[model samples]
Target: MRSSVRERETVARWDVARPSWPSRTAGVSLAGFRDSSAGPVDVPLVPHPAVTLVVEFGDGLFVVGDATGRQQRGSLVAGLAPGAVRMRGENVTCVEVRLSPVVAYAVLGVCPAELDRTVVALDDLWGRDLSRIREQLADAASWEDRFALTDSLLARRRETGPLVDPEVARVWDRIVISRGRVRIEDLADEVGWSRRLLWSRFRSQIGLPPKRAATLVRFRHAAHRLAAGDNAVRVAADCGYVDQSHLHREVVAFTGMTPSTLAGDPGLAVDDIAWAEPVAHLGVMRKT
Candidate 1:
């Protein structure tokens, strides 16, 4: 079986490259999440074109699609643990479909015993070429055929829960509007709650604070500049840092690696997608 993506609008669509990964052919599959292209999302690494995916197996694998004329060239990678926070650089376009852990939990509904096992087994299949699936969708296939298939997979996994909570939605909205550069206090105020209340919501829902989110946003900006060969000073300034050292110091605090090290460290390059979570989403350029 294959996973399908349907783009009903001209604005944003999943631009998948031709089928690869011979291992992708059958099993469970789900659609990608829908996100806005109004601004940039802070992700790790400087991915050229990527297909960002968030599945259930060991924190879903990160993907990017840099198809010509189809998407932008930049970097953004995230894990599937809680919320996947990614940053796509300017001129980098891609459709990110990262399912929340809650979504997986909802899909599973706590029935399957080998939750991770089932997800891992079907992980590759989830991303298999969905051209067939897309075609059926384009032809206005039955909702049961599409949605029901997904439901069945979750049922098999015994994962079930609410798709997401209101607090999660609230924080995500803040991330988009602020470009990942807002404060926890501000978020607290916006939601008409106290700091402790906001923190509780964050830990339980988003799993991170407003400050961490802001940090990641800044870090993403700086990483993009470095990938594009931007001067550290300029990148720092552009990303809301006091100076180049500010960028480096904060990046170290959050990522334990320097921008210079990241740029030169070819080993860090892999399947060609940002995949790890930093200490928190501190500014790549202004964490400390």
Candidate 2:
């Protein structure tokens, strides 16, 4: 299904499309975005707890750059917690895929560690197949067709690629279930591994150390809460921060914006419609 979204105080507009049903492959969510504004678009890219792949089509200028000024145009893959990024373009059209880091290792055919905290050209990882997929997506007749094509490609890659350790996967699930409040030591104990081993294995397979992963997950939840109009003090307390300032530091660390500014960001304003199920499950507002 598709919907139109406009920022509350700006002229920026987007036609957002969501899949009719859940992806057949677990831990995968798809959304298609087409910029409909008359002028160029620029917005902060908020960090989330998953690996992101953007497949750009149409004759538009799409660019993603980091805080360091490194930039890539067209299709790209961003690993977990890529800090302080921004997306800019004109007439942008793309299918954005969010892959749970647990499943990302297999579907991407590489360890998440390789992509940790950075964005790389999809072509750099997928090679020529990236071109073929772009062609197919651009040729697809409708949003549903594009979703099906993307899902099929991911399912095939996941079936053939190496899976992460069961213990590590379990830990990731625990982290999400607890909303990142779970302790790494407790998780290691529950999984019957030494703290050191779990730390090394999770970092290698899931992209971030256990502690860092928890922090990112926590921040993801807190960010959505902020965007939903929750009071900062309440969000900070509920999300496990020591105080509001601690939450402030994390918000600035992740997006280079203070809480109030991020809460009103246009990119996050579209998140509720674009990622409805995940956002709902995390207990954030239905509209941001």
Candidate 3:
């Protein structure tokens, strides 16, 4: 009966309809993908800023490196393709979780808050069986369940506060209402703090700084558009990138491949990219 229950709890194993990994060069057995053009992942590792959740339906392992392509602590890294990041085990496994970039920053506050040189043990933050999350996430479940779990995990990290501070809350309100055209200078002025001072505090609290956060916001917005399957060049210009190369660079930073590669990856999952985005600079976004 438990076995039957488990079967119904998840989509039939064969029911997982995955995209054909467009590029054979992406490597390994590919088997899952997400439409990131929606918004930041309900999980965190934003492949395009909006693609927060990735579903994986297979196994593989990989080596991870930083923006410099060197292995280091706190550097962003991820599993290559279906099984990109390698561990000692001969076999690997997974399911999928849709997370938000904010979730990573909030949870990772216990460590150095930059993506450079960071080697994250997926089991340390979430459970070892990445697939278990999907089992618990069935249609028959309660909506509050996930949010409650998120809150509980967050409490462990001690990242809960004025999600939008009373002071910052007002500013967040202004920023959000502005519809993605906000500037760091204007926010600093509104918050009654110097741009530098505000940035310092922002980094401490948000894990990432403000300007980069703005990039995240823009990427999320643009990715949502990209999921619609528009021309890459046209989409790049509309997203405020200087050109498709700029878009390609960001895509590579988040995901280890290029935009020309298959956007619909049947094998990529959020846990795989536990820490792979390059910082713009030492204290900024990742550039590798």
Off by over 4 Å in 1: 1-97, 100-160, 264-288
| Candidate with more favorable, higher TM-score: 2 or 3 | 2
lDDT of 3 by residue, 13-119 (tens): 11122222121211112222222222222122333221122222223232234344443221122321211121221122222233233343444343224432134
In order of lDDT, best first, we have 2, 1, 3
For each of the candidates, the C-alpha root-mean-square deviation to the true structure, in angstroms, is 14.8, 3.9, 13.7
lDDT of 3 at 25: 17
Q: Per-residue error at 242 for model 3, in Å?
A: 2.3
Q: How many clashing residue pairs appear in each of the predictions shown?
A: 39, 0, 49
TM-score for predicted model 1 compared with the true structure: 0.45
What TM-score does each of the candidates earn?
0.45, 0.93, 0.48
Global lDDT scores for all candidate models: 0.40, 0.87, 0.39
Q: Write the per-residue lDDT of candidate 2 for residues 134-199, one digit (tens) a residue.
A: 899999988888888999999998999888899999999999999999889999999999999999
List runs of model 3 lying over 4 Å from the truth: 1-119, 122-180, 267-288
TM-score of the candidate numbered 3?
A: 0.48
